[model samples]
Target: MGEGGKRKSRQEDAPAPPSHRILTADELGLLKVSEVPAGDKWEETAAKQRWGAPDKAQGITRLQVHCPDWSSDRCLVAAARTSGRVTLHAGSDGGDLGSFRAAPPASTSGRSDTSTNAVQALRFARPEGSQQLLIATATLGGHVSVHRCPVEAALSTALAGRVVQTWEEAARLQTIGDLQAMDVSSSGRYVAVGGEGHQLKVWDLEAAGGAAAAAAAGADGSTPKAGEPLFAGKAGKPSRSGLQDLAHVTALAFVPGQDDKQVLVGTAKHKLWLYDTRAGRKPQAELVWGEGRITTLQPQPDGSRIWVGNGRGHVEALDLRAAPAKLSMGHALKGVAGSIRALALHPSEPLIASVSLDRHLRVHHAIKRGSLAKLYLKQALTGVAWLPPLPPAPADGAREEEEEEEEEEQARAAAEEADGDAEEEEEQQQHNGRGARGKGKHAGRGKADGGSKPPAKKQDSKRRKQ
Candidate 1:
């Protein structure tokens, strides 16, 4: 075939390989939950020790736990209590990460000294090319604080090195409502603050000053000049339901990729909105998680799957690539009577760490498949997060493919050079024999044999090269 025709045929015959594989825990070399450290058995033991005793209450209102992604070298956890004191725990073994007390804001009419605030949300920002930063937000006082966690080697316990850098209120009661939920962007430069307000504000951490200045301006009723918005989509009109009618954003997560412009927000009314930070207007796309409110929504590292926790204590695995939307029920924990406080996926493993009001911090495995096992934590698991996974290893197959192509090109060039030399030798022989054969009486017979000789030699060389 002609060169162009051959190229077209090869293009049409090329096979497209699958991008990802759906493997179970056993197939992927993941051990059973009971075998891993901080597994369910340990949780059960801790639970019995804490709750199994007669003096202890069976139900817990708060739980503070951290499941750092496999990529994380260390994890930090802190829980706020009714006494206005925040107790920080470093690891599952009860190592101290740190502890600090947040006083109630003076502006409120209540007894500021005695009243306590609950920690509504906690998160560690994983920005590209930067160290992780820990952030905690309070429910009642609208207090948000940023802290610098010391490296693991610098401290005896995870909490030992925590240093509070800044504390500030997020918004005013008039413009932005009470802070219901909070999330930090993957870039670590921006924090998407959403709550009782109908609007979602993105905070730039690197902005000239710190969050304190913005928070102070927001807390005092002085109309702070509007700064550039993180998202510029058309602001949703408020309804009688207060923040519920507006963008009642309950959960926030940054899209997992190098370019940190995309964010996903889950609302109390079961609406899922994808916002482009550059656009600054209405949502790019809005979809419903289910018929119930979306308590938690987490995007997978690949950005192909989203794990959603609904109000029904049931988690759903969403196949973003499937037509008509494929939804699979993940694991269902029996004691999750209240809303799911937190959902965390392991960085490299298939395990899922979930915290609920049921006073149990449970770890589930193979959520996409039917198998469900629980890692039992005795306390009401309020919050859980995995340390981000390590960077992926470079692919060996890609390097091999490049090496093979280089070798093939060298062989093709050698074959072409050999062909050229053979052609030149045949021409030289014909020229040398021309005058002698023509002068002879047997010139006609000699010419016939000569023609066959060159053609036969050319065919033989071509075969050998092949």
Candidate 2:
């Protein structure tokens, strides 16, 4: 073959090169323990009696907690799928004040077989100097509802008690099937909804006015629209170009580092499709995760890297900013494997928390030089939210001294144990040698004395002794 052709063949067959640069944990910062606690709801039931107080009641179940940013002190929302209701809890330390029942849109009621909708997605949208907005979608239903409340309200009250503004039948697309996943842009300008269909719809809340006004605008854009093309699909066409070929999309995320507005769609087939909203073009790149179905994809704040997790329990980071010729381009972070169900990046640290079907919530720190250290949770975790750092406590010199002393003591004990083991082994060797020498001497003497004896005479002597 020609030189050029031969070179091309080798390039195509060669395995991707290894990354030369090491990533250190210090570059990622230390992941300090913030808050680790169980998410549950309990209410005391009092017995109503003529002269006595009612008895207290208690209920416990696992719940999903949604905390947006690591800097936030409170979890914005909490929901239990079994209960079929979503509760808006006040900040990281606040209790649940109000709750909402997700109901199917009026247009889709003919298709409803249940009474209430299941909460599928929850996100907090904070616009510049504006009240925080709660955006949630109902699963198996076609409705996206928005609630506006004070930031402090989350820490002080329940979402159920708050007066919620609901936008029923907000989008025009009909027979929407289900609201599979949803995401609110970091800028809080757009809300993207993904469903059973192949296309994703982006809603501009500002242009839609308020909930009441936006619902009136509906899917057809009858009134003054929020902007040109109020709702644009990731793929422009609906027929052959829709999500049908991508498998069912399970997660959606806005890319953090891209200058252009871009979003990633993760499908059941472990394929990641990146779509540019401004260009309205097909995906710029496609990545296929080999282990299991991709459950989620989260991009780092800088947009330089992306974290992807699949059903088979594997989490990897793709360095999108790397040069195309670099072998680390789109590389997976090492030492992470399992069926990952969810992932969250620590807001200020170079740490990531991933939950898996195996009920493990593992914290992976990207140490310096491309190495990683992992810490596992005691039980299988379904969701994880970073709690804001609390105030530091006063220094205790005596306590520090005591801890140091204990560590030194433990080290001495280990050393002593190792030495003891070596001494025992030497003693055993000495004993074995003594026994072997004694047996050898006895055999030699027996052989020397009987060297000239005949077989018949030896047999006669042995019989006489017996």
Query: Against the true structure, whose lDDT is highest?
Result: 2
What is the lDDT, from 0 to 100, of the residue 249 in candidate 1?
A: 68
Q: Give one digit per residue, the lDDT tens place, for model 1 in 1-466.
A: 9755654555555433221111111111111112222323323322211211221211212333344432222544454554444555433233444455443444356545333254455555544554444444444444445444433331233333544323223322211346666666666566666675545666555551343456465655342332564454344434556643655667766676626776767777777667777765666666665566777766788866677787767676655443123333333434444556667676667766665656445555644433343444433344455433222333454444456568879898988998899999989989878867767758777787788788889999999999
RMSD of 1: 21.8
The C-alpha TM-scores of every prediction are 0.55, 0.56
What local lDDT score does residue 269 receive in model 1, on the 0 to 100 scale? 76
lDDT of each: 0.50, 0.52
**With candidate 1 superimposed using the best TM-score fit, by how many Å does residue 13's alpha carbon deviate from the native?**
60
For all predictions, the C-alpha RMSD in Å is 21.8, 25.3
Which residues of candidate 2, in runs, are more than 4 Å off? 1-77, 80-84, 90-94, 104-112, 155-175, 207-211, 214-247, 257-260, 322-337, 367-380, 390-466
